[model samples]
Every structure is written in structure tokens, then in C-alpha cells.
Target: MAYNAGMTEIQPSRQVDLAIIGGGAAGVLTAINALRAAAPGQRIALFEPASAVAQGIAYATPWPEHLLNVPAGKMSGFPEQPGDFLDHLLARREAPEATLAEQYVPRLDYADYLQQRLAEAAAASAGTLQVVHDAVVSLQPQSGGHRFQQAEGANWQATQVVLACGNSMRPLPLPAGNALPPGKVVDAWDYDGVRMLAGDQDLAIIGTGLSMADCVVSLLAAGHRGRIHVLSRHALLPLPHAHGGTADFDPQPLLQLPLRARMRQLREHVRIAQAQGLPWQAVMDRIRPLGQALWRSLEEADQRRFLRHVVRYWDVHRHRIAESVHDQLMAVERSGQLQRHRARLDAVLVQDANLQVHGRGTPPFNVGALINATGVETRALGLRNPLLQQLLAEGHARPGPHGLGLDADPDSGQLHDAHGAPQPGLWLVGSLRIGTLWESLAIPELRVQAQQAARAAIA
Candidate 1:
């Protein structure tokens, strides 16, 4: 449980076969897979400052109400072992009644499954796998390998390094030149702080995404009776999963078309499916497998166009909410306790000890608190992570396309330098591959990326 602060300053330096820079699901899976594929005595080092591995921000929540967007059946940590997650849940007897394959379980349960898998992998690997509870601040290339410097003054050299650093928080989108009052704006993740607010205090949330949904859920669960104002450019909410199982559809035709044409085709297919008594979720589920290929086929202009015009709509459909959670949100909206506004935030000023929020095409409003649920920080070079900043400053890594993530070889997950040359022994997994693989965030895609990166790193 020792983090960067309490770690003994041994300045531990060792040469290992592989070094993974994160302990989230991606890093944990990569370590497990790499260790299984490595030579008998090969060593692996995993650096994570968190209290436990595999419980990244997404799964670290303790709330039972926060459920996984995807079903239990599709959340396996291993690409080859599709039933691993369900098996783990069954073995632990967690939620035996709702253990059906299509159930969207709590994210906390998923975190337990991941931790259990990581422990099992480590135990099976004997003494080859080592967990280092510290954050890596910089990665420097050396002869035949890379040297990593930890935040706690420890350094190590590895033949290969995997950057599984997941998404960072986006910068708060507050209006400029405004002297905000204390305790007015808070991060969506600060659940405790948010819970301390008065029940009848008016609140304004900055985004209309999953995080925003979670905030609303938390407030409602805490019996908050205040009016919750959700503001965004489009005010689009996530769609819910279908009641029954998902049906299959072919995405090959859509993949062959241009971005706009593909979108039109998808809309037509959804319309056809709805007319035939099938849910639109079924159609989107069919395209999940072809997401990466379809994204790669788009021209840069088309990609930008997709981001500008299609991202919000696509996100609402692609990343859905659990049926129960969706129902709760709907109930709140129906009760008039929740209000949605489609206006761009212009400024936030403090007036009479309350936050006065101004949005384009809308009248100014006052709120007791503001919450930022703007989602992940997509711009790579602007991230607050010291390691990434150091890598970019030292010319070891470059920003990915459209400022999505770090630049890496799409096929191999190998990190690239500022000169656009692929660096040996450096890899990226998970959301860091957002630019290369558009569908890299979720477990289904990340498991494949972890397997691919592990194979290349250990080869």
C-alpha cells in the first residue's frame, strides 16, 4: 500500500525484461500476458502509485450505483479468456441472482475481478512479476533499453516500457477573467466534497456525459432535493442498453464507406432495425468490432468532421448507460428535479456568495455549486502528467493526431519520437492509443491492445 511518499529511498535500479508504467486494467493485463509469454526467468516491473493495481479511476469508485456501461459478458480482462470476468464473479458468489451474462454489474465488482486476476497472474508467474507502488516521472532512452525515473527517487532500466497511463482529468472549463469564490467549483470525482453540499442547494453541472450521470445519481441517492442543471453544447444524454440480448449486424459495408456516408448508412440501418422490432443498440453493438478499422479509413478532414459534428451523437450511442441507471435519470428528469440546457458556457462569476453562470443563447443563472464533468483530457501535449510532459520536453514522444494522445505506431503500439520515428522498446496501451485505435478505451478493445503490446514488447 506504500505510495510515492512512503516508499523507501533505495534508489532501486534493476534491469528487467519489461516495465509497465501503469497499474490500471491495461497495465495489469499487459503484465500478466507478458509474464506468461516471457522466458522462464524474465523479470517484469509494474509501477503504480495507487493503493491497488487494476483499479484505475474508472473502477476505483466505491459506489454500488455506478455500474459498468458494458455488460459482464464482454468485460473480460483477457482477449482469449472471454468468460474470465463472469467466472470470477461466479466463484466469488458476487450477485448470484443477477449473474446473468448480460447484466451490467457494479464497477466496484469489476475492479475486484481485475484485482483478483492480477493476483492470480502474479502468483502463477512465481517470482518474476514485481509490483512497484510509485509513479514514474520520466522515461529516458539508454543503450539497448530505457531508464525510468520514479517520483520517489528510484530508477530502473528495462528492455521494454509500456505506457498504460490512462485518461487524465480535463481542465476545468470555467470562464476566463473571473475570480471564482472558494468551494464553488469541484471535480466530479470529489464525491465526498459534493456530498457535503446542502440538500436544497442549486447546482450546475458542466457536461452531459456519463460522469454527469454519475453525479446526478450520487446526488439523488444522497436524497438531495435541489434543482440540478445540466449544461452542454448539445445536452445529449447517453442511450440505454436494450432489455434482451443484442442481435448481430454486419458493419463491413459501413466500414467501406466514407465517414459521412458511413454515418448515413448507420442511421438507415438503425431505422430499419427499429422498424423490424430490433433496438438501435443492436446495430451499434454490431459496429463495435469494426470501430478501429472504420476510424483508420477516415481521411484527416473527415476525422475532424466526425469530431466536430458526430462525436457527441456517437458517444451517446456508443457509450451507453445501464438500464436501471437510465431509468433513475429519467425519473428525476420527469419529476422536474433535473433540467437540461443546450447552451455553450460563456462565463462563471461570483455574485452574492453564489456562482452566476452565463451561457450563450441563455439567460444567466445562479447556482450554489458547479461540477466539472467534462470527461477525459483529449489533448495529449496539454496533460498534467509529469512523465508525459517530460517525455514530450525531451523529444522522446510526440502528440498524436488531432491532439488525441501520444503518437505511436498504430499496428505495433510503439511510441514515436518528435521526429516521427518509432522508438524501440517503448509502447502505449489503453486510452493513450486513442489516436491510433479509436476504440481503445473499453475493455473489449483494450484487452486486444494489451495482448498485442505485450507480444511486441517481449518479442
Candidate 2:
């Protein structure tokens, strides 16, 4: 609970087994896993910039309305505790009839759950975890390990560093032509930005992706109904969830098959499931265990092909919106109160109070007030985080293929260097290693990675 103020320099410990740079979900899981894997008395540290450790973009829900996409049964922080979230909800009297199938809850509660977990780990740690709440600006490889240079300007040394810096947003290209004096274009993650809106405000949302959908919901929840328009290159919406069903996951035969053949077989199995009435999410869940194998099986060219042709579609289908939230969206769509357009934004200009944004698609666009909700900006690495840019410049870590994310080995999240060798002690977690493992953004997949990455960190 004690986080450093802004930043302060502290003497590096002479010896420590693990040092994680990110304190988001992945970092939290990594800490627990390290506690699980490391010998007692082996030192561990997690660096986080937020006021508290483990507060990532997703759980930093400012408004009470923001909720988790996954149901309680599936939302548990620990994979082994499949009903952990449900139990928590039940104990708190927040459980609905369909705890696993339909219950949706605020994200702050999960944040609190993580905080409690951290507290438990801290108490049991016996000085095992040395969590520092400071922004890590850069990393430099030292003898057998690395040195972390703080963003607020400090230093620490550790044998290992996990880059769980989650959710690096893509920056919007500066609008050409007249520019808004200020406060016209907003990012979807702008939790505090809601205060800037007034009743009866006309809002133009750029990129109708998941974040855009969430933003629209927030706007509607705020009673803003002047005329909301969504502009994007594609009007494609997220694929709906098919609820849940009991499905047996047997991975033995998959483990026996050759990589490519295994991927082909699993793809066919998923297709058959969808044909038989199993929802896409259910099929994906069944496929979770094989995700890593399937990713590694694909040749580099095939991986690129999937990214170009299928990544977005896969993401929308995989990370579903809750039924309640989706129904709310349907209401907006049916009433014509919300408009979805497929087109390229030509330009945006701000002249005093009036913000003008142009577009090119069926009907030309000129909407007022725009918000960028393009979800994860896989390509905008440098613009996404100052920490990443500085690290890339200092040669601590190199960018992955096509700037997908930090490069790493299949099992270990150890980021690679300029010559494509894994940096000695640096590791990444969750979606940050997406470039290495394509089908990663989910908790089940991430939980496994957290354990493996921690074990690999001992290297």
C-alpha cells in the first residue's frame, strides 16, 4: 500500500532473483507466480508508476459504470480458482442468478481483489517482494542482469525485469488544416474526460472498436443524446458471445501432433464446434491450452498473414462484450441515435468552439467532437509509451516484428536485443508479448505465461 511519491532514487540491492517493471495484471500474476516458484528469501521487485501497484488501464476504472467483460466464474484472478470471483460476489451478495453465464460487475472490485492478493503476498513474502511504485524510464543490461533508470529519475538493479506495461495506446496523427484550440479530440481511456462533457453534447467517436463501444456506453449513461456518430475504416462490430457450456479440454492428442498439423487440426475442431452450436468464445476457450503451440507452429509468414487478415476479427470474437452491455448497444443502434460509418478520416480542424472533422466514405463526414477508440495500437510502440521509446533508444530492448510489441522467445518473455538475441534478464507478460504469442490477451493464457515467465526468469 506504500507507493513512492513521484520518484526517488534508492540504492540497488546487492542481489535479487526477480525484478518486474510492470505492476499491472500480468505483473501481479508474475509476483504471485514468482512467490510460487522462487525459493524463500529470493528477492523480488515490481515497478509501477500509478499511485498503487497493480493498477493497470483496465482496472483503473474511474466511473462506477465501467465493468469487466468476463463473467464472475471466469473473472477470478487465479486460474485454479475458477469460481473465485463468483465466491467473492456471492459472499458480497452481488451475485446474480447466472454468475458464470451472465453476471457483470464493476472493475474496481477486481482492483480491490488484486490489492488484497498483493497484501497477502506481501505478508507471506518474508521480504521476498520489494515493490517500488515508480515509472521505469529505461533499462540497461548490467553484469548478468540489468539496471533500471527511473522515469522520475532514480535507479535500481535486479537480476530480472518483467515488462507488463499493459495497454500502450496508439497516438492519433495530428489533424491537418485548422486545429481545435484545445479539448476537442479525446482518447477513449480518458477517465477524467467525462467531466468535460455537458448535457446534450454532440460527440463524434473515431474508430468503432471495443473502446469506442465502451465510450458510447459511457456517454449514453451520462445522458448525452445530441447525436453520436462513429467513424472508422470499417463498420465491423465485435462478435457476440454465446454464453458458456461444459466442454472437456483434452490436450494429449494435441501435444502429440506436429506443430503445423496440430494447428490445422485445432482450427478444424473450432470450425466444427461453431457449426455444432458451440459459441466462438467456447471454442476459443477449449483451444486455450494449445494457443502457444499453435502460435509457435505458424511460420513467420503465416503469422504475418494472420495479423493482416485475421487478427482484428479474432480479437473481436475472442474478447466479447457482456450481454447486458451489448444489448444496451443494440438499443442505441435500433433507435438510430448512434451511427456507425465505414470510412477514412480525411482531416480534423478546430476553430474556437466548433470542431470540424472530415471523412471519406459513402457519405462524406463532417462531425463535431471526436474521440479515438482504436483499442491497442500494436504499431504505435514509440508514441504509445515514453518508457518504451527510451528503452528502445538506450538498447535495453528492441522492437518486435513490425512493431507488434517487444520481441521475445516463445516460452520466456525475455525481450530481445538489436541482434535478435534475448536480452539476459528482461521479460514481458500478458499481451506485451503478443508479437511472440499471437493469441494471448486472455487471462487463462496470461496466467500460464505469468508462471512460465517467472520460472524462465530464474535463467
Candidate 3:
């Protein structure tokens, strides 16, 4: 067995007990639990292109102002020890004012926390955990388990493999043959690029979700003070989080109703709760725990209807941002520097030195740059990711409900083949299970899924 101190260049063993395909939070958590549960002499390898583990696109931001959407108390990597993250923060003095569990620390800090946890798990485990800084391009089932091919490494086999590839940002949805200047369009996730934009340069950000919020906050932190145009088909900013109070609201009753009716009933219930001096946040928090079950209760058609009609509203309310962050956004909006549009982007035309963004309902406008923050690329999963493409191209996996993600057994995180047979020794966690489990991407769900997948893999 061989190992390197940091991202390894040491040749991998011919076989490993488990192979995790990504090194983001989900993959790191899965690795931590797998190492803890592994028998002596067992080998686990994690493949990731990033030089460091756990800093997925979400947590790779360098700015201190980019805080975790969830509070520190609830962002623990291990479900059994829910206070682990808070404890780490206190020990490191990362959150000096974090006497309460509600403190929202920097996202980069969370990355550090995961890296440290992974190190601790590796040191304490009886098994060998290899951090392979390589991107796995293809995975195929072999005699006993699966064979993995990486872009720049020796092929290896693993008896159990977990795909925690995480989320892919949707590219700019531009029409074919649209004339646009090169380098004018930037990815919303590229905080380094976004923060470096010339101050006072008018900018247009496409998407009105959490990613957009992140872009806005980053710009403000960087002292960007120019007309910022935020455009989306339905221009809606996420609501702010509210503290205090609990609600005993049950969503089981609404499960019997159709999707549309259920939404209406939920609205009525929220209004009633508000009238009684109970915060809507309390009711929302209650629904969040049962979100997957409620989603599963709906028929396929009803689920589609919910996605089309109600998911946006649910997202804005359910995935609320920190109040402090929300206030900063609102302050910019109130000052007339930040503006939002309810329109669909059609084309980007280069005019003189600026980019003219054209869209329906909203007149054409010129901005120095365009930022794409449209969030996840759910529709064309295979097209965007090669590993996913190979999995779908072959019969190793099939699309999940609505073709949003790969199909997997929600309970065990086991992948299902095209023929609907469970592929033994193969599993997936995090965003890949989005279609099957509506609430599968967050830390709470990912950690649980990681624990389950690890236990199964090691067993």
C-alpha cells in the first residue's frame, strides 16, 4: 500500500474495497464513514481533479462574505454527532460570536472543516483511504465490482463504487449563431472572475436563485457599484430565514390532495398560522423534514405539475437565505443599483464595446458583461458529464423521474440499471439522486445517504 501526504501521485493499488468518484462534501463524507466502518487492510480510493478535497464549486469561494446558507449547528458531516461542525468552529475560533447554533460561517471554512474531518477519520481508521487527485472519466462493471478509468492515472478496480459527482452548473442557454464577444459571458460560480469585474461596469446576471444571490453578495463585497440587471423568467429572490418558534403542522393530510390543491391548502395553512402569530418559517421547517416522503406520495404526473407550477415558490420559501445576506441584497436593490427583470433571455449581440442582451417582454439592454447563474443542469445530465454519459449510454443506469437525474433506490442509494434492476455494489449520493429524492442535495440528506452507502459498501 502507498500513500502521499496531500493530493497523491502515488500509484493506486490494483484493487480497492471502495471507490468514491468525487471529492466534494458528499464524497468526503462517504469516505469518512467508509474508513470508520472498514475492516483492517481494506482500501478506499477517492478520485477528484481538484487539488484539495471537499471544496466543491459551492464552497470553493475565497471571499469571507460567502457564508453557508445553513447555520453551522446543522451542517455537521456526521449525523450522529450533529454538533461536530459547531465544535470545530469553536475550537478554531472561526466563529468567535457563535455562542448560538445559528451562526452562518464562511463557506470556505466549511471546506476546511470537511478536510480536517477527513484527515481525522483517515488517521483513526483501521483501513487505508487514498485521496487520488484525478478525474474519473468512465466506470464500467467488471468481474467482481467495477473498473474505473481516469484522465491521467492507472486504471483500478473496486468491489464497491459510489458516485458522488455532485452538481453541474447549467451553461448559458444561448441560441445558436448568436454573435457575442468572447470572455464577456462569465460563470456565476466563478467567484474569482466575478469579483474581478471592473467596478462601475454595468453587469447582467441571468438567474434569480441562490447562485444569483451569491453573485450579488460577492459583487457588493468587492465594491462593485454599477447598474446590475438581474433577469429571470420569474424574477423572484429567495426569502430570508426567520428565527424562533416551532409549528406542529403535518403534511400527511395534504398528500392525499392533488398537487395544485395541496399547494393551495398549504398557502391557506400558512396564512392561518401567520394570523395566529406563528412564523411561516416554523411551518416551512416542519414540511422540510417530510419533503421526500411528500414528494414520493405524489403520482408521477402530479410531481411534474408540482415541478412546473409550484417548485419555484417552494424553493424561495423552503431554501431561505440568511437574513443578514438578504438585507444586504435588499439594501442594494433599494438604492437603485440592483434591478431585476421578469423576462426570458433570447440572444446576446455585440454592439460597439458592450454586449446587448435581448429578451422577450424586456427591451434589449447593454451591459459590460453577462453572468450565468441559472443553477443546476438537470435536464441533460448525460450530455454535460462523461461519466454520466457512459453510464446512460451503456445500460449501467437509467434516467430518474422526469429525466432530471440518474435513477437510484432512495433508501440504500443504490443505482438502478436501465432494465430497472438494482446494480449491486454501485451507489450514488447527493445531487444525482435529486429526481428520485426531491430533498437529497443538502448536508442533512447527503450525510445520511453517505452513512448508509458507506455501511452498505463496507458490509
Candidate 4:
């Protein structure tokens, strides 16, 4: 009934209860959740421009070498359909042992699972939930409120446009400008670019986060044996996962104390965990919900402080890889094929056949191929992306506070349009929401967000 729903916005026009942008995980998840929250015939459409319509960047990997970082058990998307992905993997013969074990399966399995869900959801709705593969370059509000135009020339008189741009590429701030030699800098997602590396060629990767780990794994899988020097402002690689030797205890009484005090007590608890042969990862995961609640209790400054200081440490400690990948990293380290430098960049210069980046610190920052593994740029709200640029230029939308991402209220998911008003017909989700929702990356967190967004649209 969304397509025929009454207009609650400016002027009279058309409607598609909700128009979600960026067809990746966020978009599809949003569509599915909206379907859950929709009336019998509520109209919804998702736009994803990748090669596959429903399969976003995660599953878009053509190479079988790339693997999902999470275990199959944890990777199952829906909270209720716990073994859905595992079942699909078994049915398709992708992973016979994956269902029972906590093994990290191929990224393709998860991608296929998402595609399967899209197909099932579509079949169930027929008309209510439709998906469009076109990319939305920009959105401009019409004379009436909440009405807008799609960059592809589609007249979208949408009641709400939810921006689910999953992960924005981190800009390469080369000191001498953003130009690199022919084969120097590469975005991690360029499947073809990553694969083209000769087995003998060495590459320099930047950043020391999970994505950096993924890139390292990708290089190893491709048989790249050359030395890799991963440099970053803070060269702290993600912590390893728990050994899972059975240690689960809760802070029964200490949890009732004040937030900061509770945080300290939790750290103390983890120390005890470490002494008891428990993995730090287990401690971190056990404390996640508590951390989130504590985070909410903190003032804005404290939140900003957490972002500046504690978040990275927490990320590495909390979200981790399987033992297999960790072993590979350790092997690379022991073999001296990999080097980590905690150096701050002073300048970057690229010349013929050679790429050089200058930094201050011991060992220094020197490399041939520099991979901008710094991850996505969260604060670029008014940058050069087609849709984002136009929205800011036309005063149709504004960047979120803290300049982290597109601003939206958590309760309503209503986007802050350019006029500094919460636009009912607009929503923002995914990693694009890191500024507001710090724990927005994992599949479980994303599923909840998508469900919330869908429910809000109908309400």
C-alpha cells in the first residue's frame, strides 16, 4: 500500500514508500526488514550498482580466494534463521562441514545467502519489494517536500530516500598529491586490480586494521611472496581470536556501578580472564553489549574521545579472525616477509617505477606499491561522490554532526536534509552511520539496523 499511500510531505506527488540507495548489504538488508515492517502491499525498492544486483561487495568477489572473516555460525545473517547460511552452503555443497563447525567459510557463501534471501523475499512480495540495480548518483528535492530526482534521470517522488552507502573508499593523501605510479596504489575492493599482481611483485600496504588483514590475506592467497611493509600512524594489528577453551563468567555485582567505573572493572575482569587462559577476544565479545550501553551513557566529548583513542584498540580486540588466518600472519611475520611500521606520514612522492612515502620514526616508511588500507573515509559528507555532492550543493541534505557520516536519528532513521530538518522520506544506514552508531559493521548489528529502518518507514 506504500505506492498508493497518502502523501504526508510537501505538495502532492508520487511515492515508493521508501527508496534505498547502495544495494550492498545495507540496502538489501533494509529492503528485507522493510518488507517485514510493511503492510500487505507496501512498496519498496533497493538500488545497488555492482555487477550482481543483490550480492554487494561482500559476495561480489569473483575470486574464491577471499573468505568471510567470521565463522559460519556467526555469519548466519538473520537472528532467527540461525543456520540459514549454513543450510544454503550445505544444499549447494559449498560447505559440508561448515554447518556444525565454527569455520570461516568463503565470502561467496555469505553473498549467495544474501542473494537467496533477496529471491525469497521478492517471490514472497511479488510487488511490494522490488530491487533496482542502477546507481543513484544524486538526489534533489522537488518543489514539494521529501520529493527528489535520481541522477539516472528516474523521477523518484520518494517519500524517503535511505542512504545505505556501505563503505566509502579512504582517500590516498599522498604528500606530493594523490597521484601514484601505474601500479602503486590500489583500492582493496578492486577485485581485478588485486588479482593482477604478479606472484613475484612486492607491495606496500597502509593501515593495520581488519581490512588491512583482509588485504594481506588476499595477497597471500594470490601467491604474492614479495615483502610487504604495512605502515600506519599507529601500526597496531588486530588482536587474535579466543582459543575457545571454555571460560564464560559474568560480572554479577560490579555491573551496577557507574559507567566509567564499570569499564575499569570490565578491564580488570579481562585481566582475570587472561590469567585463566581465556582469550581476550572472548572477554571483549562478552562485554560488547555492556560497552554499547556504557557508550550511550558517556557525554559527546567522551564518545569523541573514545573514537580518537579507544575504538581502534577495542575493534582489534573484539572483532577478530580465525586461527588459520592468524597463523598465516604469524608465519609471514616470522619469515620476515612482512614488516609493520608505526610511523606518521610527512610526505608521499611517486616517481617513475618507484613510489616513495616519507615518514618520521625508526625503520621509516618506504615501499614500492602503497595500498591505501586506511579503510573508508567516514567524515566525507560533502565530497565528490555524485549523489552526496549534489545533495550538499543543492541544500537537499547535510552531513551528520561530528562530520563522520550522513546524519540520522537512531529512533526514526530520518535523514537530516540540507535545510537542517529531519526529512521523513530520507534515511541513512551501514558503515555510513559509524559516527552515530559506533558498532555498525558486523552482520548481526546491520540486520538489527535494517529491521529498525524498515519498521520506521511503515510506522
Best TM-score among the predictions, by candidate number = 3
Q: Mind giving the per-residue lDDT tens digits that candidate 4 earns over 1-459?
A: 111112112232236777888777777777766766666656776666655654565667766666676677666666678777677777766545644447677776676677677666655653375555567876765544255455566666666667787776777655555556666677777766765663665677777776677778788887787888877877888766655543477745444565467568778877888898776666666766554355555678767776777776766777677677777788998899888878876666665566676767845444567777777777755355677777777776667657877766755667776666877557777766666666676687777777777667655
| Candidate 2 colliding pairs | 179-350, 180-350
TM-score of each: 0.94, 0.86, 0.96, 0.87
Please, what are the lDDT tens digits per residue for candidate 2 over residues 278-367? Answer: 765776667656666766766777677766777666667666777777888888888988888787777776655666666777465454
Encode model 3's per-residue lDDT on 188-253: one tens digit a residue: 898899888749989999999999999999898888978899999899998988876656676688
lDDT of 1 at 65: 77
List, residue by residue over 315-402, the lDDT tens digit for candidate 1: 9999999989999989988999898888998899777878888999678888999998998887887689999999999999988988
User: What does each candidate score in C-alpha RMSD?
Assistant: 2.7, 3.9, 2.3, 5.2
For candidate 3, give the lDDT. Answer: 0.86
Rank by lDDT, highest first: 3, 1, 2, 4
By lDDT, the best candidate is: 3
> Cα lDDT of all candidates, in order?
0.83, 0.70, 0.86, 0.67
TM-score of 1: 0.94
Which model is ahead, 1 or 4, in terms of lDDT? Answer: 1
Sorted on TM-score, best first, the list reads: 3, 1, 4, 2
